[model samples]
Every structure is written in C-alpha cells, then in structure tokens.
Target chain A: MEGTNFQRYLARKKAMSAYTWNEVKKHKMLYLFLFPFLLIFATFTLAPVGISLGLSFTYFNVLEPPRWIGFTNYLNLFLSDDIFIIALRNTIILATITGPVGFMAAFLFAWFINELPRFIRAFVTLVFYAPTIAGSAYLVWLLIFSGDSMGHLNAYLMRAGIINSPILWLTNPDYMMYVIIIVVLWMSLGAGFLAFIAGLSTIDEALYEAGLVDGVRNRWQELWFITLPNMQGMLLFGAVMAITSSFAVGEVTQNLAGFPSTDYEVHTIVNHLVDYGAMRFEMGYASAIATILFISMIYAKRIVSSFIGKIGR
Target chain B: MIGAAKKDKTSASGRRIVKVSRAVRKPNRSLGGDIFIWGILIIFGIFFIFPLVFNINQAFKPLNEIFIFPPNLFVINPTTDNISDLFIIMSRSWVTFTRYIFNTVFITFVGTAGHLFVASLGAFAVSKYDFPGSKFFFGIIITALMFNQYVTAIPNFLILTQLGWIDTYWAVIIPAFGMPLGFFLMKQFMDTIPVSLVEAAKIDGASEWLIYWRIVLPLVKPALLTVMVFAVQALWNNPQSLVIHTEQLKTLPLAISQIIGSPHAPQVARAGVNAAGLMVLMMVPIIIFVTAQSNILKTMASSGIKE
Candidate 1:
C-alpha cells in the first residue's frame, strides 16, 4: 500500500510539471509580448512597492546597510515624532477643505456648461482648461502672492483701499495654509471640471423629462432624482479622484509653502516624508509615515466607496 | 410627417412663450442673475489667465521696469534686446537648450508610442479574451491606479539605482510605457467595439496581432489620440521625474527649474522665459486638442470614460 501511494504521488508531480510546460508552450507568443512590460512593471511598480513594504520594517540610510529594526520605526513615529503628527493633522485639514469645495465648483461649472449653447460651451471649456496644459498655472499664483507690495493682488487691494499695508500672503503662518488651499483648488479645478463635464454629458435627457412627468417640480428635485442617480458611477469615480488628489497634494505644498510652514501650519505628510526620507535619508521612519498614509487612504477610500455604493444602489 | 411638423411648431412657440415669461417675471432682478453669472465667470477667467498675461507683459519690459510701482500691466515699448540676450545666454550656457528640446520630444514621442502599443494590447486582451485570472489582473490594475507616484518614489529610485538606469532615457521611457490609466481608458473604449468584428477578422485568417493592428487600432484612433494628448502633457510637465535623472539629460521642464535656480537669472527676463517655455510646452497639445476637439469629445462621450 505504501509503495502504491508513493508511485501515485510521483505520477501526480509529473503531471503537474507537464501542465506547466504546456502552458508555456501554448502561450509562448503572449508571454514574449508581455515579457518587457512585466519586467518594467516589476522593476518600477511592483519591486518598489515590495521594497517600501520591507523598508517599513528596517532602519537604513542610502549610505549604510539597512538594519532589521522591526516595527521600532512605526512605534517611534506614532509616539515620538511631533512633526509627523503635525503633518498628519495639516494634510487632513487641507484635504478636507479642498475636496468638497473643489468638487462643488467642478459640478457647478459642468452643469452650467451643459446648459449653454454648444459653441459657447466649447469656447468656455477651452478657456477654463487651457491653464492645465501650460505649466505656469502655479507660477501665476506665485506672482499674485509674491510676498512684496508689488505683488499683483496686494497692489490691487491697496489701490482699492482695502488695506493700508501689504499682507505677507506666503510668509504669514496663519494665512499660508489658506493660500496653499486656494492655489490647489485653482490648479485642480481643470481636471475635476473636465470629469464632471464628461459625467454630465453621459446623463440621458429622457431621464429628466421622465422625472418631470413623475412630479419632479424643481431643479433640485430633478437633480436628486434623475441627474444624480444616472451619474452615480461617474460621481463616485470623481470623488475617488478628488480624494486621491487631495491626499497627494505635494507639488503645490512644496513649491508654495517650502519645507515647514512658517509656524508648522501647512506642512503635509508628503512634504515631511520628502524631508526625512529623501533629504535626511531616514528611510525606515519615512516608510512608517508613508505606510500610515497608505493605510489611512485605504480606510478613507473604503468609507467613500461605501457611501457611493449606497447612493448608487 | 404632417403631425410631427405641427408638434415641432407648437413646441418651438411654447419655448418662445416660456422665454418671454421668464423675461417678464422681473426684468431688472432677472438681469441681476445674468450679470452675476457673467461677473463671477469673468473674474475666474481673469484669475486663470492673468498670470500668463502678466508673464508675457513682463517679458517685453526692461529689467528696471519689472519692479516699477503698480507693476507694469502692459509693455509700452517692447524691444528685441531681451530676446537677443536670451539667445546669448542660451549660446553660452553649457546646457544645450536645443538638445533639451530634442530630449523632451524624443521621450514624449517614444513614451507615447510605447504607451499606445502596450496599453492597447493589454486592453484588448482584457476586454476581448476570456481567460483565467483576467478579472484578477483587471482588479490589480485598478488597485495600482490608486498607488500615487510619490508612494512609489523611493522604491523606484532604489530600483533604478540597482539597475544602473539612472540618467538614461530607459529610466523615463520604460517605466512610463505601461500606464494603467491609459490601459483602462483603452479597454473602456475598445469594449464599445462590437464582438462581431473580431470574429469576422478571425474567420478571415487574421491573427490576433493583425486584427489589433489593423481593425482594432483604426477603430480606436480617436481614443489613441486622446491618450496620446494625455501622455504628452504628463511627459512635458514632468520636471520632478526628470530631476531624478541626470542633470545633463534634463528635459525642458527641468531646464526651466534649473534656469530658475541660476544666480544670474534676471527677474523680468525670467518671467518672459517662463512664459515662453509655457507657451512652447502648451502649443502642441492645444493645437492637437483644438483641431481634434469634436472627435475627442465624441469619443469621450461614447466611451463614458474620464481621466
């Protein structure tokens, strides 16, 4: 009986190996086409992700060998790092402020465009979207808040007698966060606006007429019953896009606010990560912060998706 | 046909009556809303376009004129001296501006082509083929879409370092070749293509590659163009990525950043140069978009996909 079982196991193993070889032979061309893509994807996308996950457990500098420090980095980040705490608070603040406001703006713009004549809509959309293709949209904000009396906004305000003195828009600790938020809202308006406009276009006009017949008396009722329901998936997708963008607010924060905010008011988690990980070479600690960020985003995404799913159904 | 024409005439007159009633409700008060709408839109438009206008205005002014009180709103007397000076600086600088443009064009073109090819192939496979793990792969791609570039920054840097691909075109082009977002767009677009065509092509002795290259590609040209526009914008504006590459192999965006950092950079001239750089960067995409606006919008509408 033992000899028979051993022979059966050997036969099964041989069959499994043969099956694998057959897969390779049958899909050889497919494999060949996919090879280069897989290599690059693994190298750039998958490998980096794996390494970051691993590094979240180790203490390393680019200059020295990584030490397996386990979860000490995470423990220290949670308990000890005051800056990390500030970054988390500030990033949440910025995201909360921008996400809803930006979404509403995009929605309103899209709705308005949908109501306009075709040529007018096309021209206006182009005008609104043109700034995105140009790299200096943020630079435009920089000029407006140039920190000097000569700054365009300050100049206009002073000329109009709104204030006797120029406000230090970029330098003030209290107002700097607002300034960054405004710039982000302005720059991000284009993409979200485009998405909303696309969503609005997908909504069937018959649904609105049907709502009217069903006693949807006003614009609000029509929107709630017809437009919103019809465009639920797009709306959810837009929300996800907005959330991702709000969390990943790096370039504007870095460019406008610099390293730390004037009073540690506007420094986001991403900025902190760059400071510690890239500049200071604290790989383990930065990884911990990043991992926390990742987990929070995942959690937030779950909440958002659930809310959207409820509305959609 | 007579009944349809009669119904259309009645509806047209009904619309006119509705407009007249709306106008009569409160002429001044109703005008207020119209004014308010235009007012807000105009303010926002100015807000958006003012910087580019300001930059262009500043570029034509002399260095001393840049810091004038009230900030010169427009150029009264423009000169070619700034342009001449810009050329002289470009000629003297070790960094070749022309080469930088070439590098940018090459990277954008190759990366766009690579993305179009691979993304279309991958999209076609997922959209058309029924295979084990296809759904799983699709889910993985969606999850990967949520992974921001910043999250992958350090690890990608390390990987690039390991592969000794730093400062090479491969570092930029290869990594960008398989964008999951582009793949998603393509798949969504291709799904709209009828399945009958694929079977017909197969019956006619066309291989999958031939079908993809011939039928599928031509049918999805508008999507491909839209994706191409997105790819160009991303590559063109990508200074942060290029900074990780070698200094000498810098693209135009990185070059602008470098010029910004230089000590001898003139304030007024810098604005102009940035304006010029922006104008140059935007020109191609804008022209492509404008010329293909109807086609792109129609395609986007049909596919029901958003970036």
Candidate 2:
C-alpha cells in the first residue's frame, strides 16, 4: 500500500511539472514581454529588500567585510538606541496625523472639484498638484517659515499683534513637526487625488438614477450608497499612497528643520536610517531600522486595506 | 429546490421592504450646499496656489521688492535680472549650465521611456494573459508600493555597487524602470481592455508582440500618457543624490539648489535668484502635466486597485 501511494505521489508531481511546462510554452510570448521588468525588479527591488534583511543581522561598515552578529543590531536598536524610540514615536505620530487626514482631504477635494466645469476642474487639479511636482517648492516654505521678521508668516502674525517676535518656526521643536505636517498635507493631494477625480467621473450616471428610485434621498446618501462603494478601489489606492508618503516623511523634515532638528523633535525612522547608513556607515544598524520601517508600513497597509474592504457594506 | 424557494421568498420580502420605505427623493443640488462646497473649495484653492503664485511673483521681482518688509505677494517692478543672474550663477559652476540641462533631459527621456516600455509590457502580459504566476507577480507589485525610496536606498546602493553601475546615469535610469507603481497602474488600466479584442487580433494570425505593440498600445493611449506624466515628474525632479557623484552628470535640481545656496542659508541677497531657479525647476514638469492632463484623468478612471 505504501509503495502504491509513493508511486501515485510521483506521478502527480510529474503531471504538475508537465502541466506547468506546457503552460509556459503556450504563453512563451507573455513571458518574453514580462522578462525585462521581472529581471530589473528582482535585481533592484526584491533582492535589495532580501539583502537588506540579511544585512540587518550583521555588523558591516563597508570598509571591512560584514561580520555576523545575529540579533545584536536589532537588540541595540530596541534597547540602547534611545534615538530609535524617539524616531519610532515621531514616525508613528507623523504617519497617524498625515495619513488619514491627507487621504480624506485628497478625496473630498477631488470630489468637490469634480462638479466644476472642465477648464476649472483642470486648473484646480493643477493648483492642488503643483506643490508636489515643484522640486524646490520647499524653498518657498523655508522663506515663509524663516526664523526672522522677514519671514512671511512671522511678519503677518507680528503685524496682527498675534506674536511679539519671530518664532523660529523650522528649528523650534514645538512647531517643527506641525510645520512638516502642514507641508505634507499641502502636497498630499497628488497622484491619488487625480485617481479619485477620475474614479468619481467614471461612476455610471445611471446608478444615481437607479439609486434615487431605491430611496436615496440626498446627495450625501447617494454618496454613501453609490459613490463610496463605486470608488472603494480608488480609495484603497489613495490610502496606500497616503500611508507611504506619510510614513516616509524624511526629506521634508530634513529640508525644513535642518537635519537632526532641535532635540531630535522631528527625527523619524528614515532620518535615523540615513544618519546610520549614509552619514555613519553603520549599514547593519541602518538595515535593522529599514526593516522595522518596512514592517510597520506593511502593517499599516494591511490595516487600511481591511478597513477599506468594509466600506459602504 | 428548497434553497431556491427560500431565496425567492427572501428576495420578494426584500423588494417589499424597499418599496414600503421608498420616498420620493429628489436629486437636489441645494443652494446652501453648493455655496458651502464652493466656499471650502475657494479657501483650499487659495492655500494650494499661494506658494506657486508667490514663487512666480518672486522670480519676476527686482531685488528691492524681494526684501520688502511685508513681503509683497505681487511684484511691482518685475525684472529679468533674477533670471539672468540665475544663468550667470549656473555659467560660473564647475560644470557648464547646459551640461546640467542636458543631463536632466537625457536622464528624464531615457528613464521615462524605459519605465513606460518595460512596465507596459509587463502589465500587458499580466493583465491580458492567464499565465501561471501572473497573479502572484501582480500581488508583489501591489505590495511593493507600500514602501518608498528611503527603505530601499541603502540596498539599492549596494546592488548598484555590485553591478558597477554607481556614478553612472544607468544607476538612476535602470532602477527607475523597476518602480512597481507604474506596473501596477498600467495593469489596472490594461485590465479594462476587452480580451475579445486581443483574441480577434490573434485569430487573424497577428503575433503577440505585434498585437501588444501595434494594437494594445494605441488602445491604451490614455494610460500611456498618464504613466508618461508620472515617469516624467519622478525623473525630472530626481536629485539622483545616492548613485551619481560626478558634477558633470548631476541633474538640474541639484545644480539649482547648489546655486541657491541651500534653503537653510539665510542669504537675503540670493532670494530672487533662488525663486527664479525654483520657478525654472517647477515649471517643466507642470507644463508636461498640463499637456497630458485630460488623458491622465481618463487613464486614472480605470486605475482602481482591485483585490
């Protein structure tokens, strides 16, 4: 009986391999098309994450060969590196504030502007999108939040008797994160915003009429019942964009708050990673930091995705 | 038979309940609601456009106007001096100003084209055909969008070092071709194209490559254009700080920021020049976007992330 079962298993395995090979031959052209992207993606993106994860378990500083030090880098990160905790806390705080708020703002703004005339719609889209695409637009913010009276916000506030002196907005720990959040929110209406706009437009108009017949009383109800359900896919996409942007909040903080801002107030995991990886050349430690960030981002995505699944149900 | 009977009974009751509760609800565009929405939009619009307007105005402003105490939002005595000064500053750099422009243009063109071609081909195969690992490949692509460059930068650097691609334009361009978002989006858009259309071409003895290149591509022009906008925006704005180190190979944004003396430096004298440089940096991508705006919207209409 055992010999017969073993023979059956071998036959099944052989059949599966034959089936797969036939499929491969049948779709040979498809594989040919997919080869370039797969090669590049595996080499650049997939292998890097795997390599980074492996490197996180070691102690390497680039000049010397990586020495195995399993869990030491991670242990040091959790216990000894006080800055990592602050960075973790700050990243979570930043992501929490900006992610959902930015997502909602993008969706609401896109929906609102969708009802406008075509020309006006395009113009409004440009207005919302310009700050993000503008490579050095952060310079405008630097001037606006400049530490002196010459700064626009300070000048206005002082003239209005709101404050007596310039607030040193960027460098001040109390206000730095807030400034970063505001800038983040400003630029958040990006590709996701455009996607929402397109998604909103694509909803079949006939559905609204059908919805009215089914007792959808007002625009709000119509939206909840029809629009939300129809655009859940776009919402999911937008949520991913929002989560990624909000979590990877590094450059804005650095650009505005002058790298390693006062008290490490606005220090994020990415900033810490850069400090170790680029500045300090602690590749192992930086890889651990990156691993932590990657895990948290995936966690956030999973939560958001499941939550989106329940929308308008 | 029993299950069918039960389903009928429940559906009948459901219909009755819906009918009983149904009201004569007008699809009304209330005046108050319109005003409220428009009011909010106008406020947000101002918030959005304020910086761009300020940047543009500052670029055209004379040195005196740039330093005005209140920082006038509008320029009274606009001059080409700031723009000319930006040119002068660029010319004085170790690398010629045109070299920077050429570098950016070359990188942007090659990167955008490579990404679009590679991503579209991958997207087409995955979307149109039922290959063994197609679903798994696409699943990875979706998950890939969850992290940004910060998480991948170090490992990417290591990989580039291994390939001996560091300090070359290939360092920037090749990696960009692997950006999964474009693949994800193009697949979403491609999925909307009917399979019958491809099969029809196939029945006529058209090769898969010919069908994809000649027929499938033209049909997905909006997606093509949308992806182009995204690719252009990314490559055009890329500072390429991680890989490329040669001054001659550096792009426009790096050069502009260098000339403008880092935003951290409180140089009052360089304010107008900074604005002019920023204006130049910001406008190219925006112009490209404006031209492709309609097509992008059409493409994105089909860009829903399906489970």
Candidate 3:
C-alpha cells in the first residue's frame, strides 16, 4: 500500500506540471504582491543568514582568505574558551531570573490597569511605557549610578549616612548583575506590556459574565477560568518574545557594566560573539558564536511554545 | 442501555441546575477591588515616571546644579542656555543640526512607509492566499524571528558593499522592507479577516488587487498603524545602524550620540547639552505615542495571541 501511494504521488507530480503552471498563473497577483519583500529579504536577510552559517565552518579574517576548518571552531568554543562558558552561564542565569518575572509583571500590570476607567488608563500606560521609548533611557540609570559624589543615588545614600563613600555601582562586579537586572526590568515594560493590554481587551465581556454566572467568586477566579484560556495565543507570543529578549540581554550589560566587565562577570554570549566579531576581526569565530546563539534561541523558542501550548488546556 | 440512559439524565439535570443558578447572578465589579487596583497602579506609576522626569529635568538644569555636592533631583534654577548651545555645538560640525533632523525624518518616513506596504503585501499574500510553498515562506519568517538580527549584520554589510550600496540610503531604506516583526504582526492580524468577505468580492467580479486594497487592507488598519509606530521607533532610536557612514547623511540620533559621547563637547555645558539632545531624541516618539495612543493600545490588545 505504501509503495503504491508513493508511486501515485510521483505520477500526480508528473501529471501536475502544466496544471500547476496554470494554478501559479492564477495566483500571479499574490506573487506580485510578495515580490518586493522576497527580493529585499533574499538579498539581505536570507542570504546573510546563509553566509553566517557558511562562515561558521571556516577560519576567516577579512584581510585573509576563509580557511575551511569545520567543527574546530565549535570545539574551541565549547572547551578552550573559558569566557564562552562564563558567558553561557551568565546568560542562562539572567534569562531564568528576568524572563518569567518580567513576563508576569507585564501581564499583571496590563490586566489591572485595563480595569481602570478610560482616560487615566491611557495616561498610566504612557507613564509606564515612557522609559522604554526614551532612546537614551539607560543613560539616566548610568547617571544615577555614576561613581561620583554628585550622583543622585550616591548623594542620597551619603546624606542618609547609609555608606561612608560613593559606591562604584557600575564598576563593582558584586553589584553589576543586580544593577543591570533592575534597570532591565524597569525598561522591560515595553511593547509586550501594550500587547498584553490589547490581548486582554480582545477577550469578550460576555465570557466574564458567563463565568461569574457559573459561580466564579472573584477576579482571580475569572482570570484563571476565562482570561487565561481565551488569550493562550497572545500569552504564547509574549512568552516567545520574553524568552528571546531575555537571552539576548548583553546590550544593557555592555552599556551599564563595561563590556569586558570586571573579570567578565556580566559577559553574555552576544558579547562574546561581539568580542570576536567586532573587536577582533575573526569573522569565522564570530560566525560560529552566532550559530550557537541562533541554535540556542530556536531551542528556547521551541521549549517556550510547547509549554505555552499547555496553558489553559 | 439503561445504565447509559441514567447517566445522561443526571448530567443533563446537573447542567440545568448550573444554568438556572447562572440566570440569577450578575457579574461583580466591587469598589474595594477598584481601590486596590488603583493603589498598585500609583506605585508602578511612580516607578515608571522617575527616570523620565529626571532626564527631562536635566535638560533645564544649570551646570552648577548638575555637579553640586548633593545633586538636586528637581532643578532649582532652569536655563535655556543649554538648548541654544546644543545648536551651537552641532553648527561647529560638518553636518548642521537641521540637516541631521532632515536626514532622520527623511530616512524614517521613507523606510517606515516602504515597510508598511511591502510588509503588509507579503503578510496579505501569506494569510489570504493558498499558493504553493506559502507555508514554507511563513515558516522561514517564524525562524527568522527567532534569530538575532545582529548575527546577520556583518554579512549583510558585506553584501551591501558588494552591491555598491555602501554609504547609501538604499542600503538602510531597502532592508527596512523586510523587518520580520511587521510582517508577523500584520499577517496575524490579517488572519482574523473573514474569508466570506473576500469570496463575496470575488463573486462580484472584484480583481484580487481590488479585493486586497478595498476589502482586506482597510480591515487591518489598526495593525498598519501599530506597525507604523514600531517602524518609527526602530528607525528613530538607532544611533548604531551600520549603513549610514557618510557624514553628510548622519541621522539625528547618531549626531546626538556623538554630542553626548564626545569628551570635549564644551565641558561646562556637556550635561545640559546631552540632556537637551536626549529630550530631542525622545520628543517625536513621545508625540507619536500620545497621538496614536489608542490605536497603539488597540493593536497590542489584538496582538500576541497567535503563533
């Protein structure tokens, strides 16, 4: 039966060539609409991704020819580079702490704020979202944590006699991770937060009424019964975004804590990739780092999607 | 048969009891819950506003106030000298201040408008059409979303150089058409449009283009507006975009970062100047946020529910 089915599929394919051409002709308008995007994407995005993968297998520094040295790059990254290992560990830790925490905070804030009467809710949303929108928002945190007597946080701490001297907030490795994490969380209430608010509104009011009628006692119960089940799709989207951003979190560290952070305490995989790619001209090694980062994000997305798939089931 | 009949009867009876009781009750909206919600709202409000307020306040602070023994959170004596000097500082450079603004606006408008059409067209094709390999195309988009864009930056730059697009607006503007987020969001939103509407148009002899433009595009207006907001944000905030290398074409954010990052951007006025730049950098986005505020919220409400 299987052999016959395979034979039939092959026969259909051979017969369908002219017929498929007609179908393709019928859909020419869609193809036309799709052309510009595909053209640019093929040239820039798809081609570059392929290039990065190709480069990952070779030893290339722009001035020299790309020497094919497959798997050695990967092997070196795993075993020889202690810095990559530290970066991997730090990235995992940061993701675990902030990813889920920020996700929940975003949802909770959006949900509660949504319950407010109209105008005030908009005002509040703007307030919460402003920091993320402010392009140099992180610069403000840098100022607050500046290792100067005049820094606001330091001035307050000194005035209150909490410490003897102005602390090196960004420089000190002991406080670096915490400071970066806090600042990240503060700025994390961005598009995803707005997404949750929007997602909440899409849920029908009739569902809530029906849920209460079925003996739902309070807001929490209604949320568990009706809201979560209804917005599973949005939740999944938010979770994927949250996980991606969480893993891709070296920028704040690069900005706040110096890049080769004191003993590389705050280094992330992206920073390690940049260290090779940008600072050094080892394009092949950087590509290898990027490949690993790419693979990890895909893996993270898979795990997150599967987990979200189980929500409200 | 008897046992099955008895089970069905009991379950039906139970369902009736639920329905009858459900008919008696109304949805609760307690004042106490409202009060508690407001309390939490106020706390998060303060937490969110402090950094923004401080940054804005710095725009008006004197250099003395900026570096005082105990730095003032609120400006005691506000001044416009810094704002005037920000212009003076830019005038000293090869690119004038207004030129940066023009470059930024031009790039942002062209890039954003291009993305709006190109992305939506791609999205419309995927969501509404049953063309061969459509699934594969969309799958590639999903995969693209997972990967960090920076990983591709080097190779993309190399590609641009090969095409002789280096130091050109085409290098920047063309790639904006392919942003995965805009495509993803628009496609998801378009998916919700009813097939019957398209079918009805087709029955009335509407061309595919007409059906798309008149029937489908208008339905996803909220999504389009939201994408516009995002496109503006992405183009405006980036001081680090690699494409624009020519001094004549430097955007506002790049010039602003230069002003802030320079060691000798007039020392006494550096803080004030930096603050003024920060304000300018954030101003347009803030205005957009305020103006399209509802549309943004509406888009968010509809988004993130689909894979």
Candidate 4:
C-alpha cells in the first residue's frame, strides 16, 4: 500500500509537468510578446527588491566592495539609530492619518460626483486631479506654508489676529507635520480617486433599483448593501494606492519642509533611505532601510487586503 | 420617507407606469443630503483650486504686485514680462534652451511610447492567455505596485551602473518601461474585454501579434491613452539629474527650476519669473491630463483589482 501511494504521487507530479510543458509550447507566441516587458521589469523593478534584501546584510558604501555584516544594520536601526526610530514613528503616523483619510475622501468624492451629469463630472475630476498632474506645482505649497510673515497662511493668520507672530509653518517642528499632512491630503485625490469615480459609475444602476425593490429604503442602505460590495475590488485598489503613497511621503517633506527637515522632525523612512543612499552613498545601510520599508508596506497591504475582503459582508 | 416608500411600492406594482416615470432615474436623494454633499464638494473644491489659482495668478503678476503685502490672489497689473524674462534666462544658459527642450521631448516621447507598447503587449498576453508562469509573472507585477521608487532606488542605481545606462537617455527611459502601474492598469482594463473577441480573431486565422496590434489594441484605446497620460506625466516631470550628470543632458523641469532659482531666492525680485517658469513647467502635464482625462475616466471604469 505504501509503495502504490508513492507511485501515485510521482505519477501526479509527472502529469502536472507534462501539462505545463504543453501549455508553454502552445502559447509560445504570448511569451515572446511578454518578453520585452518582463526582461526590463526583472532587471529594474523585481531584481532590485531581491538585491536590496540581500545587500541589507552587507556593508558597502559604493566605492568599496560589500562586506558581510550579518544583521548589524538591522540591529543598529532598531536599537541604536534614534533618527530611524523617529522616522519609523513619523512614517506610521503619516500613513495612519493620510491613508484612511485619503481612502475615504476618494470614495466619498467619487460617490458625490457619480450623481452629476456627464460634462460636469469630467470637469470636477480635473479639478480634483489638478494637484497631482501639475508636476512640481506642489511647490506652490512652499509658498502657502512659507516660513515668513509674507507667506499666504501666515499673512492670513496675522490679519485674522489668530497669532501675534507669524508661524513658521514649514520650518517650525510643531507645525511641520500638520502642514505636510494638509498638503498630502490636498493632493491625495489622485489615480485611486479617479478609480473610485469610475468604480461608482460602473456599479450597475439596476442593482440599486433591485435593492430599492427589496426594501432598501434609503440611499445609505442601498450603498451598504449594493454599492460597497460591488466595488470591493476598487476599494482594495484605492486602499493600496492610498497606503503606498502615504508611506512614500518623502517628496512632500523634502520639498516643503526642506531636506533633513528642521532637526529631522519630518524625516520618514524614505527620507532616511535617500539620506544614506543618494547623499551619503551608504548603499548597504540604505538597502537595509529600503528592505524594512518594503516589508512593512507588503505587510500593511496584506492586512488591508484581508480587511477589504471582509468589507460590506 | 413613508410617502416615498408608498410611492415606490405602487410604482413597483404598476411597472409600466413606473418605467415611463423612472426614465430619468434620480434616486431618492434628500434635499438636506444634496445640500450637504454640494457644500462639502464646494469646500473641497476651494481647498483644491485655491493654491492652483494663486500659483497661476502669480505667473501673471507684475514684479511689484508679486511682493504686495498679503500677496493678492488676483494680479491687478498682469504682464507677460516674466514669461519673456524666463525665455531670456533660458537662452542665456550654457546649453541652449532648445537643447533642453529636445532632451525632454525626446525622453518623454520615447519613454512614454516604449512603456505603452511593451506594457500593453505584456498586459494583453497575461490577460488573455494562461501560459505557464503567466500567473506568477502577473503576481510579481501586482506586488510591485505595493511599493514605490524609493525602496528600489539603491539597487536600481547599482543595476543601472552595471548596465552602463547611467548618464544616458536610457537611464531615464529604460527604467520607466518597468513602472508597474501602467502594466497593472492595462491588464485590469484588458480583462474587461470579452475573451470571445480574441477567440473570434483566432478563428479568422489572425496571428497572435496581428491580433494584439490590429484588433485588440484599437479596442483598448482608452487604456492606451490612460497609460500614455500617466507615462508622459511621469517622464515629463522626471528630473534627469539623478543619473544624467551632463548639463546638456538635463530635462526641462531641471532647466525650469534653474530659471525659477531656489525656493531661497530673493522672493521680491525673482517671484514673477519663478512663477512663470513653474507655469511653463506644469503646463505640459496639465494639458495632457485635460485632453486624455475623459479616456482615463473610461479606462479607470474597468481598472479595479479582481478579488
């Protein structure tokens, strides 16, 4: 009986390989089509992650060959690097606030605009999307949050008698994170937001009608029963977009608050990574930083996906 | 609420009458809810639009008006002098302004085109076919979407150095081809296309390449435009300063920033020119988005993660 069972398992494995080989042979042209992208992707996008993970355990500063370090970077990151702790904490706060807020705002605005007529919806979308596509237009935020009395926010506050002196909105450590949050949220209505608008529009109108017939007496009830469940795919997508962008909030801080921002108050993991990688050429340490961020993001995404999977259930 | 429920029930029962009346199916939206939503939208609209308006207005402001106390949102004495000054500054740079434009336009065009072509081809194959490892390949792409460029910057630099692509157009354009967003979005959009359409093409004895290029590509125009817009936006804004070290190799955004001077530049004198340069820098992506947005919306309609 044991011999027969082993033979059966071997037979099944052989059959699976044969089937896979046949599929590969039949769709050989499709592989050709996919080759260029996969090659580039493997080199640039995929390999980097693996390489970064590997390099995280080494010590290299680009000029010298990498030396095996054996978790020294990770140990330093957690136990000794006070700045890394601040960055990690700041990243968590930024992601926690902006991720959910951006996600909800994307959904809510999409739902709101879904009720509008055709052309108006398109125009409103442009209005919402302007902040993102207007490349470097985010520099406008520096003007608004400029650290001087002549700055827009400062001028307004001073006029309103809300403050005795101008608040150095960008430079002030106390106000920096809030200013960054406001700017990020302002620009947060991005691709995910567009996806939500599209998702809302694509949700079958008949489902709402059917839902109404089934005693879904109000818009809110209809939404919970029909709309949310229908667009769970988009909710998941939007959430991922929101979470990833929220985690990668270095550019806003770098540009607005200035790099190595005001005693590293607005420093994030990405900034820390950039600080080491670009400025300092500490490739191995930066790779370690990148690995932490990559793992944390993947972990965050998994949690979000499980939660989104249960939405409207 | 009771009256509406009664009406709805009657309408459901008298289906023919309901069909005519519900031709314009405005769902049961309360006046208060409508007001509240509109109010919120308007407030958010201001929040979204005010900064952009202020920025654009600054481009038009005369030098003195730019430095006015409280910084007026509207420019009273608008001038094209700043725009002219921006051109003069660009011309006086060590590299010709057209050289920078050529570099940018070349990079943007090649990068966007290559990305769209390669990504869509890959997307089509993955979406329509189920060859061995197709699912695994697609899984990687999805996972790639969960992170951004920051995480990969270090390894990417090393890899580029190995490839001898640094300090060349390929450095900027090549990596863009691997940006997972376009491929993911293309696959999502392509999934909505009927499999039967491809089967029909196959029955007509059309080659796979022919089917992808001629039949399916045309059908997914919205996705193509959507991807193009995104690619263009990214490449256009990409400061080529990262890998391309040569002054002549720098892109438009870098050139524009130079003319705009630093954020620390004396704001009173440079404000008008700075604003003008920024406006010029921003216009390309803005214009591209505005033109392609309707198509983007259409493409995005189907761009959802499959459970």
- Per lDDT, the best of the predicted structures is 2
Model 4, docking class: medium
Residue pairs clashing in model 3 are A198-B300, A198-B301, A199-B301, A233-B305, A234-B304, A234-B305
Better of 1 and 4 by DockQ: 4
Name the DockQ score for candidate 4. 0.60
DockQ of 2: 0.44
Top-DockQ structure, candidate number: 4
Best by TM-score: 4
Taking the tens digit of each residue's C-alpha lDDT, what string does model 4 give over B1-307?
A: 3434555565467556545655565655544556666788889988998888888899998878887897788889889999999889889989998999899989988998999999999999999888899888888887888768888888888998998989999999998987899999999899988999999999999999998988889999999999999998888776867789898988888888766666654355677888888888778888988888789988988877875
DockQ-based CAPRI category assigned to the predicted complex of candidate 3? acceptable
Misplaced by over 4 Å in model 3 are: A1-22, B1-35, B262-269, B305-307
RMSD after Cα superposition, model 3: 6.1
Please say which candidate is ahead in TM-score: 3 or 4.
Answer: 4
**Residue A121 CA error for candidate 4 (Å)?**
0.9
TM-score per model over all chains: 0.85, 0.93, 0.91, 0.95
| Runs of candidate 4 exceeding 4 Å displacement | B1-25, B265-268
Specify the poorest-scoring 10-residue window by lDDT in model 1 chain A: A215-224
Q: What is the lDDT of residue B164 in candidate 3?
A: 89
- Can you give the lDDT of residue A166 in candidate 4? 88
Q: How many angstroms is residue B167 displaced in model 3 relative to the true structure, after the best TM-score fit?
A: 1.3
Residue B73 in candidate 3 has what lDDT?
87
Best-to-worst TM-score order: 4, 2, 3, 1
State the C-alpha RMSD over the true interface residues for candidate 3, after superposing those residues: 5.6
Chain A accuracy of model 3 expressed as TM-score: 0.93
For residue B99, model 2's alpha carbon misses the true position, in angstroms, by 1.8
